[model samples]
Target: MSNTLRISLIAVASAAVLAACGGSDDRNDGYTPPPAQPPVLNVTKVDGRYHHNKSQQDSGFRAMSDMPPSASPAAEIALPALDAQAQTKAQGDSLGGPILIALPQTVAQAQTAEQLASLLHWRQDAQGQQVAALRVQAADALGIRLGLLVQALPDAALLRFYPDSKTAQGYETTGAEINAVLRLNAQAGEQGQAARTWWSPDLGGDAITLEIVLPASAAAEALQLALPSISRRFVDTDSDAALQAPPAQRAGLSKERIPSAGSCNLDMSCYSNGSAERDAVARMSFVRDGKGYFCTGTLLNDAIQSDIPYFITAHHCISSQTVAGSLQTDWFFRTASCGSPYLDARRTTRTRGARLLYTSNVGQGFDATLLALNDAAPPGTYLAGWDARLNNSIQKVLSLHHPNGALGKISGGETQNYANCDGRHCRAATDGRGRYYEVRWGDGTTEGGSSGSALFTQSGHVIGTLHGGTASCSAPDEPDFYGRLDLAFESGLKNFLAAAQRPF
Candidate 1:
């Protein structure tokens, strides 16, 4: 049969199934149906007209030339060597698990304001701003992330991290931005130690220099900065060459890339279809418990089709607002061409951080988390549509994800049945009762970093997000489960996705 005929049959079959299962009124367990009409999923790219207003960065920034040389070299703190055996074990076990990269280490000294001041290399810029610098060294590390416990950070204070002090290239942030994220986390009931700390992004290198710039009026003692801990990355998941190295050469191989997904996985570029779906997906890298991890998330289009940068991912990947605040997304993280090994360097973009809007626990039912990105998505990105109708039925499904944190890959599958699944264990559920869609892959398979990927229906509308399952390259016939988007829509997602709420 033709593809069009096959889809028509599937839809008719679905309508019949819904009617048999109790019709529209009783299809949803106990929740009210959405107010808007069913989504239009035929469009390839939702236009950028609805894109949210991009926030402007702080202006009047001074370059490195404005600052004078430090009176003395900053005191250095050296970190311990990475455990090769532990890293190998983590990599092997990560296939069906979280993408673990960094290891936590405590700062032995200079945690307090007084001690930090003593160790800092103090200087004054041409503008007379007080500048202090500190160096952190971790031999052979792929990257470094610092955790700061701030008591009070003045509005005028600016923080910058760089590999070299002479050059201008570095990550810069204001105290207000950091404190704002922390406040959001606290409001979301994230009171854990991780929530209390503001994590700095990982600047690739073995060592990094931290520079704090304060107005001349503010004294060194005025700043209440504490460095309780830092995370040192053992793997380079974000690098373009991460998948080039062999398994045997991976251990302690600084130049050699970390292994990618199994060879059986299919690259997204290999397919001509699903261009919009590919643009909507992103590779998510985050820090939790002082360890770096990766997952996948998709940009979602709301009822109004606004480009609010609303995102959806697995609750398991980011259950709390604190972890959401730590999210860094890589867009257009695919190959340069069809079946090409090299990445499209010009098209790739990275955005930092997001605010957690809503989330449902795994134990509760559907494992999903919604977020509003802190920055606007890059140009040419798409906000994917979703189907939340209770009567919606998925026949053929597709998943676009970055497995093993490498380049984006696509997997094709068919929806088998409704199931109640937690990780690998799955059991059949009564009609209209299951929280997940049990899927069997025919082409590619999901791996470690594929968690939180969107499950797209034949018409290109998302119906679910990837939850844990037993599917892999070794067991292609095994099933994978995706938490139902219909269930998620009923439980708080409607507030943002539907037209019921104020414009997001």
Candidate 2:
């Protein structure tokens, strides 16, 4: 059959499949179908470093003196302790695989920018620029993330967040960028409670200082920065305790010293033969509804083999650009070496934020979300190959994911059958029209943070993304369902994955 005719048939079949699956057919219901072909993307390669908006090397504060004086301390607030037993129970009960890590706390004085400005300590930096800083301390907390409601911010203003000790490692952004993200969130129909709030990246430590630097010509009175609430992470997924040890001492510590996946979970480093495939996977942590969560995602190579940082994950994890804009990924988040439990302390590269390209939920027949990162992928990271053809005969499969927000783990399995899954239950698609690939694991199992991880064929080409199922260490014989990537490609992924022209 001619290529044109083949595509036409597939399109008709896809429409029928959606209708059979009870998906919305009404165009007015806010469901937009993918275009026939992928649009050409204009991409420029970067220096392979994580530069979100501005350079990370740029320190807004020149020295400790640049910060506000201790006498005029910003409003101090302490978050309530999260219940350890409750957190464990919540993890066991999570069916869709998003591990909760933080609790939202309301700040009484953050009702408006005017109210917040009164709490900040205003000073003049060495550069003679107007600077105002607020220090929020959550004693004994693992991480702190702020939610800012940008009402009126000056274009010349710059915002930076970092630990009190680490001045250079701060994450910086501009008021203009925050406003732009808020506008994008509004356009995407994200008008929830956290709609106008732009979440800051997880600044590791108990206390974080938010500093705003205004141009010499700009007036601080014109600035508007409101903090309605903040999220305090009680878990230590990005713990740096291991780094405090001497290099030789860290190398000799036993696996028992580090927190990791279950004993049955296989380390991805053990199977380093597929280094490219391993590099393609990343541990993803994102914020939604003022809470922090974890999942997995993969970097995908398009048909033209362009390195555009196109990413794939389950739609259930992230279906909106607003959440996508809060994405932060840990590259090379595996062990230090094969069979070792020590995390690679040297691999500290983390890319922050993304732009949601396309997404389809389980109700739409398959679960998948495509994203374009705000910054370039880390150096040496590989873009994974994919197989978009629907073929149930393909048997052997593999998966690499971060279980319970720990180091990467590998699972080997085979496709058993097609099924329609709602995370809790699954029914066999007797007519062979199911949207998910049901697989029973033989080597390892998945956990709460493993959702959206890729299910790859033996050839290292991804065929599906994990949605959820009962498969675990306790029930190795039970099946796990992955939303078929072929179905996702047919629905809308083709617009980004099936491009013909090479990236410039």
Which 10 residues in a row give candidate 1 its minimum summed lDDT?
Answer: 16-25
lDDT of 1 by residue, 232-261 (tens): 888754544443223342232233243477
Q: What's the TM-score of every candidate structure?
A: 0.81, 0.81
Model 2's number of clashes is 0
Per-residue accuracy of model 2 over 367-420 as CA lDDT, tens digit each: 778888766776667788788777678487888888877777888878877888
- Which parts of model 2 are misplaced by more than 4 Å? 1-75, 82-95, 164-169, 236-259, 349-351, 501-504
Q: Give the clashing residue pairs of candidate 1, or none.
A: none
Candidate 1 wrongly placed segments (more than 4 Å): 1-72, 88-96, 164-169, 236-259, 346-351, 391-394, 430-432, 501-504
lDDT of 2 at 380: 62
Pick by lDDT: which candidate is best?
A: 1
